[model samples]
Target: MSTDSTSLKLKKEIEEAADFLPLLGTDYIELYVGNAKQSALYYQAAWGFQPLAFSGLETGNKQSASYVLVQDKIRLVLTSPLKEGGPINRHIDKHGDGVKVVALWVDDARKSYQETVKRGARSYMEPKSIEDENGEVVLSGIHTYGETVHVFVERKNYHGAFMPGFKPWNPAYQPEGTGLKYIDHMVGNVGWNEMGKWCEFYAHVMGFAQLVSFDDKDISTDYTALMSKVMSNGNGRIKFPINEPAEGKKKSQIEEYIEFYNGAGVQHVALATDNIIETVKKLQQRGVEFLKVPSTYYDTVLDRVGQIDEDLEPLKELGILIDRDDEGYLLQLFTKPVLDRPTMFFEIIQRKGAKSFGKGNFKALFEAIEREQKLRGTL
Candidate 1:
């Protein structure tokens, strides 16, 4: 791939993206961390998530313990190793408390597995049935770009708070929701040359279509460069951006993540909000740090993006970024690294009518990231 080329690889874009697996929305995101207890508490206190459920030795199930946190329709399952040499611990050592499963809510887990496997997705697991007094739910799995896996969850027949075995988690203190609605999208950082290979896999196996593509020309800055292509399933509910580093004058953010994370993994999770101003304000008050762009960025951004409904003052006050496409505009802000490794973070996005990622903000975003990398001595 030429770093200077602005042309799209037409062959790689799915002409008529398939719909073999009808997905509803994100069922939940499961992370393999070193400590689930503390992580759960951090989420509830910092992000305003509520304790929803728990699963562990109390149920005599597996060697790991998992705490499920909830806010609105969003669910996060944090799993930790109970002993030294277990699968969860291995993941923690390798990826350092990162996302493992991006589970999708589906209509049929059995058919979801069969159709995807037949279409060339690497089979992570066949459909399995799990039942409790509440009801029965089926699950299936398949591998995506790297070690990350996608689990198909069929819960039409289940009525428990979460999956079976996870009792209600009634912690002594529960925090209120922070106005976060659900997952807007998930972005992944891949190896230097593997972005298109997995994009094609999603087009075929997972029945996704190319929503948009940003070559080096669209996002390249003088010191940094990378290419991104967004993929979305039918109904436009799920979106994934696959990113790979491109040749540049300095180290790209995607390269830095792959280095410290030990391999390709989820770079960040974008959370949707109806009001980003209030949500980010509360988050900052609760100790969430965000990336700071130059004061000049807000000066001329309005000229480029045209007038928006949001007052320019608060957007600047909150360090929020703005972008516009043919459809409409969106307001987004980035949080600093959620863990010590600088691997995973969060994106707070509020879309008015825009159906695209913030292409216009890429240069500033990369520059902000580069500043952080220099401080860490990684650039």
Candidate 2:
């Protein structure tokens, strides 16, 4: 077959899949960390996440401590084991403050679990209900790539601070939000040649369709290369772009992640903001470090992305990257690794009608990452 015809056929087949287990939106992302209290404080002070709820010994029957933080529609749960030698502790030891749960808000947890489990998903948690004076919530989970799991949270009947066993955390140190709205998407880095396997899992088990795909030629620097595929559910509320290392002269970022993380894991969480310039200013003032591309990057950026709404001066000053797709353009910046290991980070993004990831900026972005890896002696 001719290459052009083959491309058209593949594009035609990449339509949205059927929605079996409807997902409302992201419920909360829970991270297994070493110290939930200190981490909570860090997020509050640095990222402007307000303390929303707390679960620990005070809540009674506690094996672990959890601090829930919220900013707009985004909710983050930081958890730490109160005692040693448990699964949480083991996860911490293995991954070192990485994401463990990507919870999806659903209307019926039982049906969600059953649909996925019957479709060949490995069960992580059986559907169970937890209740308090406020209401009741049903939660079910299934294992995904690495130690990470997707939890189906049915909270239509709950209305308390968070859920059962967590009280409202009204601390005096609530910082003003930085205009971060909600999770735009999350990226996962897998081992070599495993991206397609996990993409298939999302396709068959969760009813997600492949939105886009990138090869090594599309996302590569002078020394590193990787392949990626973007997957999205029926409603397009949740998007996951799975990445795997490709052959290159030096180590790619995916290789470095798997080496330090010891397995496949969540690479970064991209948070959406309405105002990129102001939000980046607040985050920088609050001491969140971001990757820097050369000033030369801005010299010809506009020539590539064409006219944008924001002034170029502040965006260049703040070191934010800009990319344009067929739909529209997006402004985004990547933070350095938030934890000790260079595993997980955050991507602050502002999409101005763009429905695609930043494919136009992949070369410059990967070059910046290669510089960081050189400093860490990992590349």
Candidate 3:
């Protein structure tokens, strides 16, 4: 009867017909940084990420060092170049420490790479096997946008601490997790007018399907504008929303990211949590700064989004936003730039049942972002 209900019905139909990619979920996300040890501490102290494993000169890798952190199903590998003039150094010099690899768990890494490469994807890594005492892992990759890569990881046979070269790292101090479950989605900011091409790459090459599309009118405020298309696999475990800057009165956030990140790169990581209030409290206590909306935005938010179960005060107190679709509602919040370069940040999200992203909170969310941009003198 309602628009939301009809949309939900169509969504189910689309899922039924979507192609299965024989993929599990995100295995891990690897980031290139200037200092792996320092960044690992930052994640531990700020985001309650437990030190899971590590690899470096300690593990006989002389070129680079990597620290693996885990919070529930989400894993982050922070890496840094140990030498100059290497690819890692070049990546950091150009992009200043952003997401480099989005590793996906799959049943067959070789088959996955073959399917995508045959569909016109550029090869980044040919399928290779690495074995250790635990077992062996098959890894393959293909270039996505910019220098970003999608790594298909077949670890069903491996049970080591992590991959092949890493050793288990259990430190004396570890931050308690903030109820973060896993990655909900990873958002990318492409160069001008590149969103459509990348979205097609996901659809045709990776066997993903377009879930939703947002134009500038829907995602912009008065000063900045961007267009985005959400793409997901058949089972809906992996989601990637590609964004491209649209013409606006001023430079859009996507454009700013592309400029500072030196071409296209990951914009933000959306991590799913179960309890918003508790997770926000824990993150805030650990010194994580979040974007804030005007308190006035919450005065009528409930009236607009319809009946919601969460008390408005906790949300307003923590700067969390809420939206309701046909299936249910979701609570979400955005973090300030994790780095000084204003390139990459994170999102903590909790979806009760709503399949849609927070379309209702776009204006308020962008306004909050614009305020941050203004402070940084980017807008």
Candidate 4:
């Protein structure tokens, strides 16, 4: 297995673009960090994600660290550079640790790469074929905002559960998964006047259609501001919201991420689960701390939102919150920043046939975050 840059070959754009629609779901999310072992353990224990595969010192990966973790349908690979002065280390030092790869499962890798490239995408990784007895798998990558990337995965020919050389991690340990079945959404934070550039990239290069748009007025506090536009595939299985900080009294969260990360990058990943109450219960028991809203917010929740399916008792019991709009309703809770810096968080979300993002919950969620900021002295 040659891991040389020369082995990477960029595919030319196809004359007729590949039908890049109807994304099945997220294949895997890769995060570049400072420590993959500890981060893998945290996901396995706290997030109820089990170890699916791993690669490191024993596997002849002498220059880096990596681990693949799974929870039901969701798969995440954490990778950190072993030595300093590399691209991965620079990403961690600047971004304070965040997602680096959003791998999308496709039928054809070369065609997918060609289709997106023809639409004017800047290439990150050229289409490369990795194979073993299980068969061959082709992969390609394109640049997105910040240091983030979208990897196109063509696995129809590969029969292996994951990539080659990874043993099925079956430990005596099994924690109740946090109802997160698949990735519901992944948000990106871009720099000022950069949202449109990235949005246009997705729209033209990847054939993504705009799902929704929100301005600083849509999601803001008196002290901070942000503008967002959500892009999704035709079938809507994949959703990405691009955000840029707007002028505010103080530095906005988007601004903070861009400043510390030294550029644009992913902000948070919202994982989907069928049963949020059970998921939250298990996560809480395992040391995953979520942001908490004041009790008073719940007092007027029912009156403002009217009737819903779930009983209010269970929601309050698990500290889960609900918000509704004319379109539909969504249940979401945010994890406190997990990394050392005040950046990179997770959103445990369950959508009950809702298509819209949880806009109604912004006020309560921001206030909870503000409370944390106050304690950290960042506010």
Q: How far out, in Å, is residue 14 in model 2?
A: 9.1
Q: What's the residue-level lDDT of 229 in candidate 4?
A: 94
Q: What is the TM-score of each candidate against the true structure?
A: 0.95, 0.96, 0.95, 0.91
Give the range where candidate 3 is weakest over 10 consecutive residues by summed lDDT: 1-10
Model 2 RMSD in angstroms = 6.8
The runs of at least 3 residues in candidate 1 whose Cα sits more than 4 Å from the true structure, single-residue gaps closed, are 1-15
What's the alpha carbon RMSD for model 3?
A: 5.6
With candidate 1 superimposed using the best TM-score fit, by how many Å does residue 149's alpha carbon deviate from the native?
0.4
Clashes of 3: 0
- For candidate 2, write residues 154-246 as lDDT tens digits: 887788989998999998998999999999999999998899899999999999999999999999988999999999887788899999999
lDDT of 1 by residue, 37-116 (tens): 99998999889999988999998766889999989878999999888897778888888999999999887889999999
Residue-by-residue lDDT tens digits, candidate 3, 75-181: 99999999889899999999998999999988788999998899899999999999888888889999999999999988777777788899999999887888999
Model 4 clash pairs are 94-261, 146-264, 179-273
- What lDDT is reached at residue 320 by model 4? 81
Candidate 1's TM-score reads 0.95
Checking candidate 2 for backbone clashes, the offending pairs are none
The global C-alpha lDDT for each of the candidates, from Candidate 1 onward, is 0.88, 0.91, 0.88, 0.79
